[model samples]
Target: MSTYTVTSFASASPAFTETTYEVPRELPAFHVFVDILACGVCYTDLYRFDAVPGSICGHETVGTIKDVGPNVNHLKIGDIVGFGYLRSSCLDCHQCTSGCDIMCKERKLFSHGPGGFAHAVVWDSRFVYKIPSSLEPKYAAPLMCAGATVFAALYNNNVSPTARIGVIGIGGLGHLALQFCRAWGCQVVALSGSLSKKNEALSFGAHEFLNTKELTTETVKAQPKFDFILNTTTGDLPWDLYLSLLNPNGILCLVGFQEKPLEMKSNHFLYHQARVVGFLVASRGVSKKMLEFAARHNIKPMIEEYPMTAKGAANAMQNVRDGKVRYRAVLIVPQDSSKL
Candidate 1:
């Protein structure tokens, strides 16, 4: 048996608790032995905690491969691997076959099994990815989820080098989206409700910053109509205002999941032939593409590291849920585990 740290949901008042779990000596299909070095807590993890009780919730993972099952030939012991929110999918599905496992009918998410928050994650090799030695594991964790999602959205939407892109909100997903957009050669505009984020947004590579509360149609008219807008805020946006900011055939893609339904004007879309699209992460096929793109551009998430054993781990989850983390929060497993 192996003892590991695990976060689980309680049936009563205390929703989340840290506990020790023992794993039997049997192996699951396609399971890889991963000594988790870092695990990034995402907003999605909070959603899982709220929606599913007793779930192991984390997705952004970075670790060293300790073992690979019999059928797994691509990965070996001592290989550095990373995984995003998705754990498994049915390859025979239409969405999976079309290079869109994000839309797979039987997609298995991280909450369904042993997630990144644990000391070791026994995951399917198909969901595992090799990481470069040059990139730090803590910094690379969020890219597996946040970076990959935004990168895939931008690339899948055909964002051009000359495209004017707007990244809404300066939180976790938005921060990384800003960097990806700027590095993609697109003119990036940071749109947020607070003026305080202006300087920080500029530091993250935004060419211009707009306070959405102070925004007017004149301000929208002054700048070039956006080719695309990446709405990364956890809440709903004023859809009419966002749609009006777009040019003909301009697209506004949403990556965040808001609690309530969003309202919008249908006439706005019809007038400009604009689109409001939503994308999750990428397929197993395109994840490599996303990582390679980040590797080439040096795009990575700004992460704050915490220890897995620290009392702050639970607080970090609440911080992410409350929108207090500067960008990303990663839980660092004990360094000695790296040798196990």
Candidate 2:
């Protein structure tokens, strides 16, 4: 059988190492081979570094389809596509049938094989979405993961345009939340521990900016309550304090992952009938809709580019770890990779 060599950055050693895998010519039904052009470096990648050693770890992938299986009629060669955190899920489950594939018990991640950190990837076409022509590949990469996350929270929760939305942590996910909420005609409040990103947050569509570090109980009481508060930071925040800021029946949604167990008074939510929910990445249908909505509204993440090399990948990871990236980091593949 014919085979192709795929080069990727693997975490086999302390840092990333150059590795190659041989992919067979024959693809499974409903699968496609994608030539990765760009991939976004997410904070989740950092968390997975130590957990899955010797694995390729990138999910926010953007590329063009190079080959397709016989059953893949919707996607063809030369079509620009993107893959998020998920590769596929068992279609027989209730969650999958209800359009909540991300919640499926048997869902597969793109990181299972040669991920987007490589020059190419093969994924189930059901989860791979087409990129809109208006959006650049590098810009669309972040949307595959980060954008899908925040958008799913709002869309799935039935957040209305008239709702008062508060976004905590103006980083990768938080930044996109601001733009999406604002474009949806909601009143957006940007909440952060510092004012370092005040101006940028405003430009991204926040109607108000609050420095949480300086927020006193009295000051918090004076502010208006929010209908929905989305927390996108990994930091262990003052949960009770944020819960107090919610309006009656308001929702506190968490999209960030932290190791520590969340602690908060039950009475705080009980008294106000408030609800707390943890959101994973977007479902297949929601992910596809998010791309279309982002393209139509021109919502883009502020990103810094790095070359798709072992050295570049290491540098980008360090920057993300140190909280140095402006908003998001994207790795760009060289155009001459055909020679590889």
- How accurate locally, in lDDT, is each candidate? 0.80, 0.90
lDDT of 2 by residue, 93-124 (tens): 99999998888999887766668888888889
* TM-score to native of every candidate shown: 0.92, 0.98
TM-score, model 2 to reference: 0.98
Model 2 lDDT, residue 105, Cα: 93
Per-residue error (Å), model 2, residue 200: 0.3
What is residue 33's positional error in candidate 1, in angstroms?
1.4
Give the worst 10-residue stretch by lDDT in candidate 2: 10-19
Worst 10 residues of 1 by lDDT: 5-14
Candidate 2 residue pairs that clash:
none
lDDT (10s digit) by residue, model 1, range 1-340? 6643333223111245555555533556677878888889888877776776656667899988876777888888899999988889897888888888878889997767767776776888988889876678898899888888898899888889999999998988888898888888999999998788889899999999988997776666776678899998777667888888998999989988877888988886788899989888877767888787778878788878777753656767778767778899998887764333
Q: Report residue 146 deviation for candidate 2 (angstroms).
A: 0.4
Root-mean-square deviation of candidate 1: 2.5
**What value does the lDDT take at residue 244 in candidate 1?**
88
RMSD of each: 2.5, 1.1
